[model samples]
Target chain A: MHDSPDPGDRRDAVCVVGAGASGLTAVKNLLELGFQVDCYERETAVGGAWNWRHDRSPVYAGAHLISSRPLTEFPDFPMPDTWPDYPHHSQVLSYLERYAAHFRLGEHVWFGTEVVSAVPTGDGGWEVTTQSTGGGSSRTSRYAALVVANGHNWDPRRPTIPGEFRGRVMHSSAYKDPAVLRDRKVLVIGGGNTGCDLAVEAAQQARQVWHSTRRGYWYAPKYVLGRPADQVNDRLLKWRLPLRLRQWLYRRTVAMTTGDLTRFGLPEPDHQPYESHPIVNSQLPYYLGHGRITPVPDVTAFDGSAAELADGRRIEPDLVITATGYRPRFEFLAPELLDADEQGRPDLHLHTFARKHPTLAVIGLVQPDSGVFPLAHWQSVATARWLRLRLTDPARAAAVQQKESAKPLASWSKRRVVKTERHWFEVDHLDYLRSLESLLNEMEPA
Target chain B: MTAFDLLRFEDWTNPVPPADREVVSLLPEEDDGRPPLLFVPGLGHGAWAFAEHWLPHAAGRGFPAHALTPRPGGDLRAQVHDVVQTAASLPRQAVLIGHGVGALVVARALGRYPARAAVLAAPVLGGWSALGSALRANPGGTLPALVGGRLSLSARQLFQSGPPALTAEQITGYLSRLDPKPRAELLRRATPPRPVGDAPVLVIGSPDDRVVARPALDRAAAAYSGAPLMFPGMGHDLMLEASWAEPIDAILDWLTKQIK
Candidate 1:
């Protein structure tokens, strides 16, 4: 499969897509594995999320991570303990920068290169196509191993608001800081964590803040009783129990653990065991309690300053923050390798390696309340090991792929583990790491 | 419990006593077992806060329920210790619930004991961070230490004097049950560098919350990689308010969906 490196090849050679967390990890690990690697990042700099500052950065410019330092960090590499429990978006970006530098991943990355297409060539190798993010440059290269570490948040998902809204409207992804909504009547849409956080922040600065949710939501306080709510809830749901009983228990447990909606001027939920919103903290209710924000109904339509809700209520809003979630963006890929379900999300197998092909692997695709770093780290390790095996021992690689292929795509939570069903790729970071290590061990020659 | 034991936890207070160590008593009858749901309370609150709000609602809705409170009486740290003790005693792997300052404690606990789902509500994140200072400065008694660890009865009586927006009576009863030490200690624990777990998170928040604020919860949830449930009308005492049932139900519903 050696097509022949140009008579003079100065570039050290493994192709990595995107220089985000997973991509960087793969690059670092590849170096550790002693392979010459080439990393292709669409962004100009090494930091992915970090580089996407509100002004110049793309993808989660205003967004901060939900994962904490200890859990967000790598197994061997620990983040500074001094960082807050929940670091700001900038801090995370900064941390990624530090990680890249420490691992020396910056030197190998081609900052402006974005992978446009990848095809498996003869001899089980890959031919890659690229477009420059800057200078409009285009090029093609071939690599023995390909690691697609392009993160999941690359694409933006806009909601189909049944009716048009005339008020100043923007997606949560477009929201950078709360400074833009000063003194205006702001309506924050969506029941997700970002919506809640933005609603709360806007409540303080805007003349009025209206948060709308179609589904009844649970405002999970960061702490319960005297600890973080996740710890308590996770503990309770981590068993073999009836789903009904578990839901019941979860309701009672959270209620006892946190405060009620009245404190925030919001209506009581109609449903039991309200769905968990991925909000960062629980203290948001206090802002509502103090009359800083108002919780309204789902927006049905809007005409200028006034917006109508599904509940038949109309409220005037100066601005509307549609923190409506996001979708996966894989525009650069060819139709053959890129297949998405009805939701437009790439139909990944185990959420990592592409289902249709094994040579092409995807990492950091799973969305969790905790940070993707842990998962990304383990995924990179697994992909690396798998690639190594495929290169040295194709038979073993084929066998492993066959077994992975045999497993059904939809499998989940024998216990109360919450993960996307389509991306049934959730793993306990620690367990996944160990499993990856074992897989790596099996690949070594005696 | 001794102070050191309170610090070490597990050794001093076991959520479930040794005698209560039963194997798999609460398994789901039909579906494959999801992780257990463990609920931890935020600062100045106890498991009773949730029970008062959820129990009546769950019963009305025909949902079976249980609320683990701070086993009758103890200091703040002791109650927190007891909570950890009692929670660990339950079946392994449950969704953990934490609110306000309590979210930090649960984060630490999860750091020690990994769970299935982590739902942090209106969290204060690290109460000692740059933003936390502002929250601590607010007059919500979140900073009970500023008034000295021991608040006078008249001063302590003021939290109830404010309004009926929340079930003040329930909040009062909850406050009357607390001893000074754990309250201060609990607040102190809500500082930066709070522990974290790798479980999927469902964060609940309100923009108008005064004490903990949305920024704190936002940052905390962001750290956890959790999905958020934001509302505009809720107050800091959400779990205890009249509108609390909806959010509580939402959390439970999400847990079921998540595990399924």
Candidate 2:
């Protein structure tokens, strides 16, 4: 209710939307730089997606961080040593709460408040409107800059089929328990990590399980040589082997461990290993081999409790769960501000700063193959430093902005082919991390 | 009981049996079927290796599979004789599937016996280039196995750093079950039979195989005029590897076409 200082007096203030990992990091970095911050979160608590208890969270009962804890945790605040290598969603939420308490970030955040809309003012600033979740009262405030960190997993992209089926159908976001699959023939569609996990769970309880995938994916075990796969990848990078030799060694290792996936009736992966997001599920092959789960091709159409496959096979299932993934939705901001590409991915410099408006930035928008927390942390730091540099030195800010604008989108995206809409914002974790480090280095105060 | 239980050594005093060169048969559900499939192991490996997964899979697919375990103390000639004798005992012509040094025995034995078809999975054709690559990849294992009378290779060398699905305990258990081979047999230069005859041959190779290079496999396929099928990312142990079914399926498809 306008209890803070006048917007004109506090021109160095920044408004952060969404109190998620990116939002919390933005608040911490902005406050550390002595910038007054106003963070708005629709939820009553911190830990946006990790807060599995929240109604808006897409996390399910079986959800766990695909990346290990060490890589996912903030560098300044490491997860507890007692936590498992792959901590559950609840543990992640707890770790986020601990991070907020350690940095006193909750004080800067406005809990139970939603940012209704944010529009760029003509004077290189932002006109933000917020409303409390409890009351419908709207508040207008002006800020020197705006950081959108609302994340991209809330809106489920449910694909429409040509025909209708006489079975219970729901998106993976609506699935919370394996009880729905008990004693029923369940068809889990999609070859992503979520679909694999759900298929593994249903294999044990469902009367029959049919897994459908449109394309093949490289599946890696969670552990390699008794250590996490991501950790092994880091160690391998330090080895400094030639790219060809490294790829050969990695291919050999994967073949030895995962065996030939084609034997399990799945199609051969169309791309090389690590070329895209790998499905890291160890139990998938085991279940497929044991005949507890059957792998099928993509669904071409549905015929009353039966689904027709693209390969000319049909399956009669009692229920179907679509783990088809989510689309990046930023409805709070106007469409014109995004300048999205043909794939609907926003044209941001280094996946962070806007080319037209350097004052407006987006953090944690990438779907990297590995942990996103460290990447998000570095991105927020770069953004905060850039904002400060823009205010203090216009020439240097313009130079940095020019370089970012010239950066090619092809260099940022490494996929040979983007198969689905969900992969539109995908970034190779190692490449993106290096780019972030360089951007951070360039943004350092002279 | 596991094949290891039967072949388990009591101590140094108790020597292995000489008559243990008998063929171990894994018949399918039906009594009579098509020609049975015969599997031959490479250096330092026993019939138990194929028994792990391949034999059961082939038997389940209605093709009775058999593994030929050669007598302990023998040269390459004697090993080839053992394979020939085992094939003669089968009621009908059998499909020959050989791996590593066993492939050499199968190549020699095919000249003397009648086989429905042959599937060579990572065959060691003993060309200088192929031997050079094998030695470079695994000097510690390959050198000792060739020079000395004992075959010594670690689990890492055997499975090419071990498969992911198998735990350390499982690998150790498998390693414990392995028996040493006669070095003279593994080191001897393989002389390909004058002509491989009219028997259809399928040569399966792994491009990433460290033990058996693809060049040697290519040469073997060329010599036999066989259809060469290469699995791009697979390692040497095609039968025991996670994707063992790929080669199995290929062999099955070839056999189906041949029979028709």
Candidate 3:
């Protein structure tokens, strides 16, 4: 460590903005690459959103991982095989804790410390300001690079309907327990995996449940052929099967398992499989087939205790939940730093590297079909490799950056995703991981 | 594609089954920032070999030492999985020390697991000389190992049989606990795996090692470290043989002074 500097100008240190899975792994990889790192976390503990004790955490009591354990775990450090296919949120939290402790990542992290601002100093370094989570005066320090892993799920994105509801209306983030839905009529909006999961929970606790979706979607079962379905899909991708055949196989499997959506009085899928984000929910189909939950078209407006469906049908409910998803937010850094548009969606090169500033990267801003942790892990690995290349040979690193900047955004999934706000960051696991592997080759070739 | 890119997807989908092996550890009263050391014992042995001497010896000097008692398997991949899985469970990344066939296991496992550093002690690795040495030292064991049968090793053949020889009861107690391997799992005809990335490696053994020759250790050092740190007059199982403390002291010196 540098002895002392005026206001601690640590030229070798990289400032990381979170201690979540992405941030912790970033610190580990950076340290492995011989770079000093100072990670700041707003919460008192690590695991970020996975740690349910924190107020910003989106984890709920009924939550089990939608993706199976194999596809979800970090590549270097896996969850024990004793853990079931889909582990509970508490288990995931413990796994993250184990990861943090094993790698000694906690020592590098500054708990209860939050980065308030990070501005580029025009000399390829960033001046980062920090403040304690509790009331405290802010401190500023300068570092060589910045990695923004302040996750994207904490912000609430409650879509505006025509009129306000007279009764209770809340975002899914607030619905942490089944007690909120007990003996109540609930209306849940959106068709994301979380939406399906919340609806499934409502089936157990609520008096009546209604699920509203903007468009009919293909629902994949959590398991296929008695194995985790994602594993089966990954195998098909590894073999490089024809896209149409894979999609057909996926549709066939879902049909064989759950039958057609219309058979259960739900609308037929409007889009092809893989055109949007996957919703792996076998339980949602069971609840729907058992007539515990009713499927309806998207809600257009809220009138008192009633939500008017787009098909002109109205359903009255005690609680209306807007599970419309979250928008990625980076209020500390300038919008232009991340190349974020008006909607605050970062236009990162691989949904990671910032072309405007090669030293800047934003990890965990993706919504891949597989687990987010492994993707974040690979992203950090690639980013650390790039930064080390810069440290050793700036001219070559700059040339690589120039070549990479001209390439199109690396979001190449097998299926052409519909350009929608919800699927803005959607990526196929195989395609994204392949792109990252090739990108890593560019910085650290074999 | 990088080795990791191909293995990444496979490990995620169809991982190696979790290894149900035994682990023995020794801890220091005060840690002086030394990395943990994990030892994989040679063939026809259990973790008891290291737990007997090297573990307490290393830990006494403030290093956390561990040993893996791998389950007997015919395939090399199974042993590699055992080593990698046990290392991942540790509180820190360990300096992996492999002995005899365990050295080959550690080498292959580098493709899958990252280590703080590595040491191949009395390595049964590289060249036809290793087979030739094994043939000359114990024709009875080598002939059986070559034909898919367990190698027959008398206790004296492993430990130092000259000065500080093991007593008859000491020999019998250790022999009874051996985890013997079949011919399919021995070191020769091995596929070369990815090398350890950037971590410093130390190849330390003895020229007097009964089961391996000087040329074999030199080749192992050639593959990893630039030069072999030879501890002469020690047996093949350096961690268990007579003059064991001398080799371990050199290892501790290297870990503390050389790597840092």
Each model's C-alpha lDDT? 0.59, 0.76, 0.82
Across A1-446, the per-residue lDDT of candidate 1 in tens digits comes to: 22334632323356888887788888876765557787888777776655664233444434555544544655434444445555777777776776676555787887777788777775556777777775575667777767787765535556566566666788876777668888888988877677877877787678888888765556656655564454444444344355588567656765675556655546665554523324555656677667777777767766656888777988988788887666666666664464675555666655677766666777787655455776677667667767777778888777777766675533411223423332233443333443444444555453
Model 3 vs. true fold: TM? 0.94
Q: Which regions in candidate 1 have their CA more than 4 angstroms from the true location?
A: A1-12, A54-64, A162-165, A231-249, A260-277, A410-446, B1-260
Better of 1 and 3 by DockQ: 3
lDDT of 2 by residue, B1-260 (tens): 00101011111112112344757788999955467888998876778889888898888888889998867766666676566556645655567888887887787667644466887888876846545765686677667656544555565545645334456786688778767554533445656664222467788888788777766778888877655798766667777776778888888887878866
Q: Between prediction 2 and prediction 3, which has the larger lDDT?
A: 3
Best by DockQ: 3
Candidate 3 lDDT by residue in tens digits, A198-301: 99999999999999987778888878876788888888877888889988998888767777888666887777888888888888889998899999988988
- DockQ of candidate 2 relative to the true structure: 0.01
Better of 1 and 3 by lDDT: 3
Q: Model 3: number of clashes?
A: 0
- Counted clashes in each candidate structure: 177, 4, 0
What fraction of the reference interface contacts is present in each model, in order?
0.00, 0.00, 0.38
Ranking by DockQ: 3, 1, 2
How do all models score by TM-score? 0.57, 0.62, 0.94
**For model 1, how does the per-residue alpha-carbon lDDT over B1-260 read when each residue is reduced to its tens digit?**
00100011132112322222111122233433344555566544555666666645543443333445444344544444444444444434445677765666566555434345677777756545423433344435434555665432222221322443545565566557654233434445432332322357778877666555566677777776654688566666567665777778887788778756
Which is the winner by DockQ between candidate 2 and candidate 3? 3
Which residue ranges in model 3 land beyond 4 Å of their true spot? A1-6, A410-415, B1-7, B30-34, B126-129, B154-160, B167-169, B183-198, B258-260
